[model samples]
Target: MSFFYSSIVKFEIEFFGHENIRSNHQKTIEITKESHLTPQGDCIVGVNATSSCADLPLELKNKLKNSNSKIKFTISVGDDEFILEGRGHPELILAHTKDIVIRKSDFICPRTLAIKCDKASDLLPRTMVSLLQNPKTKGTFTIDID
Candidate 1:
């Protein structure tokens, strides 16, 4: 009789660093579920008028619709304001998330905002990203409606 035993090592890695968390912390910004502060100090924002985020400000909605091909929006975090430019696909935000089907019900055509950060790492926190993309999460960001 021969006995064979195998041990599979499952390593869970964390991508977020101190700078990444700092970049996302202490800033009161309405982040639509699509918005997330990447470990690289960058943020991914979504500009959409889907039913899920219809409650957003009218001006913001207009900007999202009229911006059309343009991918730039001014946002406020804590006291500082930044101009977020559109880069990645809106669906990319979804793909970055875990359970996308639950939150994404209707077929929404939303634009993307790829904000850059100077002090971010190439890696991100898996836990934080999970919360950002959670179905129960509501996307919100604090910006000047005027």
Candidate 2:
């Protein structure tokens, strides 16, 4: 028998934090294309994002839609860095234009970048979250799938 495997796929996005970033939501972590944020958006850690789900490369999106794919989400801000592990699902559409979300649940949605994530907004380090409350904070989000 013969088998085939796909090569690793990578995508990166840049965004800035907002003054309203709370990062308190228990189930999700999110980055949005919108420049402004309200306190109610507790899952949001970054705003004025350079890329949304709709902007992800098609190759990376394809990998993210595969049920067998493993995903690594790397977040870097100044000197601090965080790594999140997650899995892809066949249900992922990766089509939302305004937001990119990572969820700890298995729920699938247009904005969801990865489901069954190992961490959520509330699980992030408090020090990192504090830095994210400043609009001057710059962040890089890198996604790798295989």
Q: What is the lDDT of candidate 2?
A: 0.90
Per-residue alpha-carbon lDDT of candidate 1 for residues 1-146, written as tens digits (9 for 90 to 100)? 99976421111111111222322332121232333344443333222213233344444444433323233334322233344333222232222221111111123333222222112211224344444343333333332211
Query: What is the C-alpha RMSD, rounded to one decimal, of candidate 1?
Result: 19.3
- Listed in order, each prediction's TM-score against the native is 0.26, 0.93
The whole-model lDDT of each prediction reads: 0.29, 0.90
Error of 1 at 46 (Å): 13
Task: Give the TM-score comparing model 2 with the true structure, all chains together.
Answer: 0.93
Candidate 1 local distance difference test against the native: 0.29
Q: Write the per-residue lDDT of candidate 2 for residues 14-52, one digit (tens) a residue.
A: 999888988889999999999989999999989989999
Alpha-carbon deviation at 39 in model 1, angstroms: 9.7
